[model samples]
Target: MPKEIAGPEVTPGARETQLGEWRIVALKDASFALDGGAMFGVVPRVMWERLTKVNSDHTVPLATTPYLLDNGTYRVLIEPGMGLRWGEKQTAMFHISHDEGHELVTSLRAAGVEPEEITHCLMSHCHWDHIGAACGADGLPVFPKAQHWCPQSERDAALHPDHLRRASYRKEDLQPIIEANLLQTFEGETEILPGLKMVELGGHSDGISLVILETAEGKAAFWADIVPTSNHVHLPFIMAYDMNAALSWEVRTKWIPLAAEEGWLNLLYHDLDQPMGRFVVDAKKRYTFAAI
Candidate 1:
């Protein structure tokens, strides 16, 4: 939404797709902006600016997306976008926009899936953008019936935030879930539910984890911040936003090649263009993205 910046328009409602034995709905939430410099990390702007557009303020628009994995039994929602609770100042800072196609709640309703129908809300971490929507304007669980799943390490980090985290881990965003005592946390690689598993890959955050699922074609991974967007499909494109650029690089090196080799279903949450794709290795072993 937020006016596609030279990308195909995604339908407002959810579309059904098959991933082996699983049903997937790649949900759109909102379009927000971030500093282009931070997004590109050490990459020189002279190079990256050519690859993507930037606003007058040097901020780039990013997609806030969540993925729904349903196997008829479990309704799992991953990466619920920034909640609809931002004030004018915060909105201005983040440049959050609400195009009909990207409004989180409306998109969910339009998809014919009500909030109460979500059985599990698996969070990649407690980063404001990732966990903000677990609760809503009323400060109650938006998906009232869903159990909020996250990494215990992330919850602990959010609870005892340091200077580096103070800005990223917003207390107001997470208070409701904590007050409701609904948080269900896992340690490392955990199968929080049937057919759904997650493993911590600390790059974006201290406890940032990627969600994995069983797809019809092969294994699917939601590598969270490891590969936030399609642009990052290029191996060297790390973001300055990552807490551990080294760790992110290390993880990308390990997981990306496997994703390409094994034909894993890859989900890019922050990619404004396409959300689902597979990694392909060219004759020279260069990675490229092929949308599903």
Candidate 2:
């Protein structure tokens, strides 16, 4: 049984902040929902329920938050989008919806960027929710001129997911990008740009990675599904859908504290209301988030 509760409030738009030489913006895309129980993993419903509202079907709303990293010379787009590939059945099932202005291309245009202007497209993983907009309806790459990057393991997983994981991936999403000769796959920690790097942390999926950017001004980490929402700042809040729960715990244990102590700007991918924030450890030695 699900209890009636209010959904997280969302501020819809292009949220921007400047980190050193780069202008980082969280571009809105299709919003959807996921099973609350699966989202909270081992955490009890009574414990996680208070942090977020639940739909009648026990699903919690999630935001598809992709980021745009723009330095004067190069424009990097991370976690492309939830995309527009969902059919009416899937859309209704997931409660997916986005206004015209919230479309990836529209959001990019609103941020004063054109699709072709994107120099690099990075996907933390190839899960359909994360790389849905890799192509368009015409089966063409959306960022036609950009060099797309993904973890080699994730690329393989997306292309050939096992029986239990097949539902989370779609081959069509990556086929066009592959055929275009624009997709670049990496094995481990690789510096994609001067100050930007991808650190592969396998947990939620085999090849999910963390995108980190550091410059003279400050540092920021794009926490793919590792820490999808601010509510997941705690170390044990791993998602049940993760392929490797123990690995997720190990990764979160190491990174969450580092982000807090260093005061890095933590960019969340699925938090609907609070998209970006800083992890803070209080006097009580408990983790809390200071939303940005």
Candidate 3:
């Protein structure tokens, strides 16, 4: 029998109290290091580090929680985790390890859904960590029967990656899916599945994507890597991992309100502590974390 990878226990929050008919499954839990100065953008590390502890190596912990929406017909997986493709140097640099089985296949099976059953495998972006699990050990498409959806611009960028981003775009990670003919490229807002929409926002990476799930309760936006954690909910908490910080700020400003007003569940991809939550306007009218 495979060992179970423990996920963070859910705490009672506003969403559960109000919206009652949604189910969430944590796909994988993993971490990586990012420079402290870069992670906070212009903000001083003195201020930002106070909120969350940074490792000695300076990279903060990241999680990949791929939500499974079984709306009867569709079984969708939002961004899969960084898979087992790290070399020694990469592993040492990022401190990547999978003792608890960071395998999405195992996690999904435990959740009662098979890889072939997945209707859509949404690539939130082309970042190595975000898209690593999209392919498998043999460098082939992991989800054979599912359509791998990514933005057209992202696909183009991946094919002709720049010197700075080249290292992150490994052929082993993406080529198999392309060869398998499972890659389905999309432009702006497109509905790959009924009630599930892809919102195109380009800042963190070129043509970064977000998934919107229309549930019986309400709409939930799987904001991949944008607001990676609950701590990043603040407008100024832009990641150093983002290539274009200015554009990332712009996207956040626009989406934060849409999240607050409609009470949309902000599904964070790498928040170790608070994986999923709803944005709230506090007493001072600033956006804050209201975990679900």
Candidate 3 per-residue lDDT over residues 73-176, each given as its tens digit: 76778887788777899888887766575667887888788989987788877778788888777777778888888898888777888887786566566778
lDDT of 2: 0.86
1 against 2, candidate with superior TM-score: 2
For candidate 1, the TM-score is 0.91
- Model 3: how far residue 39 lies from native, Å: 2.2
Cα displacement (angstroms), candidate 1, residue 158, comes to 1.5
Residue 30 in model 3: shift from native, Å?
Answer: 3.0
Per-candidate Cα lDDT values, in order, are: 0.79, 0.86, 0.74
lDDT of 2 by residue, 69-129 (tens): 9999999999988888778999999999987466888888999999989999999999999
Candidate 1, poorest ten consecutive residues by summed lDDT: 1-10
Model 1 segments more than 4 A misplaced: 1-16
Per-residue CA lDDT of candidate 1, range 1-292, in tens? Answer: 1111122222323244667666777787878999999999999999889878799999988887888887778778888888788899989988998776777778887767888899888889888888787878787789878888888889887888999888888777667887887778888888877667888878889889989886445678887778887778778889999898888889888888878777677788887777777777677766767664
The pairs that clash in candidate 2 are none
Ranking by lDDT: 2, 1, 3
Show model 3 residue runs off by greater than 4 Å: 1-22
